[model samples]
Target: MSVVNNLVDIRALAALVPDGAKLVVAKDESGVAMAATRELVRRGVRNLHLVTVPVSGLQADVLIGAGCVATVESSGITLSEFGTGPCFTRAIKAGSIRMKDATCPAIYAGLQAAQKGLPFMPLRGIIGSDLLKHRDDWRVIDNPFGTDDKIVAIAAIGPDVALFHAPLADRFGNVFIGRQRELMLLAHASRKTLVTVEQVVEGNLLDDDARSGATIPALYIEAIAHAPKGMWPLGYGDAYPIDAAWMRAYVQMARTAEGFESVVAQWLAGDGALKPLVGAGLGELAGAAA
Candidate 1:
């Protein structure tokens, strides 16, 4: 999988995601995730799983209403608090799609087990929690070498697709994530991957700085979209600032399923509803239209 440098279009990137596929989104407030989610819903994808480090701003509300079975890595937040009143929240409480903390070795081992094509991995934690109640997928087996009572075996999560946004990419799809390594592991573990980059540069930007080229090479990349300001709402460090007003409006509009669909439609129609701020590279398009 040496797909480090290549450039492709958004449509090409979106095409890789099939209907009814289970998608895992690396949680970020970035417009890239927002746009990717909108596209997934627009394409009739029903099972969407969102994975984020214990923090908000991934727009859980939108995914839940779209019928996506959302999952979040536990970060000291109680199930009751996390499950609140959102649609996906309720679904989680109702047991439609399971939720657990990957920060724990048990959960991380489970994902690793799946990535390695193993059936399960032995875990010492989660002995008395309700996580064991749903043991249909997990099994408690005795440690052959030890006198311990039992260890929980967690299953792997190999998602159907993964989408992420990077700071720079070449026309051939070589991505440079800069400092935001955000969920780079889960993105690589997925069967297919889509990347939306700020600008498509030529040659190897990684040659100048190896620290910047932390993620997958171009071979693993399915497609690269030249989407400037795609990381809106999530600041790209020195690249740009978060758009607070736009993020607030986006969250409100995507609160309903219908509104979510409409937003995607507007985006596809080139109405510039989700377009980046002026002077951020998209200003030329705005000016040409005017």
Candidate 2:
């Protein structure tokens, strides 16, 4: 495909996400692609295996509330200062979705194993915790070298698609995640990396020595969508700050099925309530990163 083809609209981006796919999302509070996520909901995408890198906030909660998710594999899902995610809490309470609870480090290790093309990754913690009891894919292996010590091994996480938002990306598709280096592992671990960014730069990001360490080259990015201020309700550096009041309102609306629908309806229909979150509007979204 031509470099221009990589940039696509939000609807196109959402359509690129196959139903029932194993979708791994970015980390908590940072790099959460809420703009693309809203598009996914609008498109009615469903049965997703939503894996949060570690912890999650609005992205996971909104997807769960929209019924776009079938299973959630994560360390935990909360709205941070907003407290527990109402929709996630409701789903767990109702047994509406399968849960693969994990620790923050374990999730990171799983992704790391996949990035390294390993079958599994060994971890040190969660040795005596109940978290291990529920996970069949984890095993306790004795130290074969000496001293008879045991460590936990977790299966590698190889997602069909990895998604996140960033501050900027170059026209050549190099994504600048800045200090959020875990995104590099996320892209490496997944079969495809879909990105949405605040803006697109003109030159090649890899050519800049200062940003080389913080950039995920075009080779790892499969698609790009323009989503200025896309990370709304979830801050991304100084470009924006979390919309605490909106989050609180969402928490209230998500408390019940009907209330949640009210929020979804407003969001999907471009109601004024959510206009601030849409940033540059859908028309300006989806551009070739390469």
Best by TM-score: 2
User: Which digits, one per residue and each the tens of the lDDT, describe model 1 over residues 85-114?
Assistant: 344444566676556544445545655675
Compute the lDDT of residue 46 as modeled in candidate 2.
94
lDDT for predicted candidate 2 compared with the true structure: 0.83
The reply for model 2, stretches above 4 Å from the true place, is 1-4, 274-290
Candidate 1 wrong stretches, greater than 4 Å: 1-6, 29-32, 49-60, 68-107, 249-290
**Candidate-wise lDDT, in order:** 0.57, 0.83
Residues 221-271 of candidate 2: C-alpha lDDT, one tens digit per residue: 899999998887677787777776677777776777766766776666552
Question: Each model's TM-score?
Answer: 0.69, 0.91
Residue 230 CA error for candidate 2 (Å)? Answer: 0.7
| Cα deviation of 201, candidate 2, in Å | 0.5
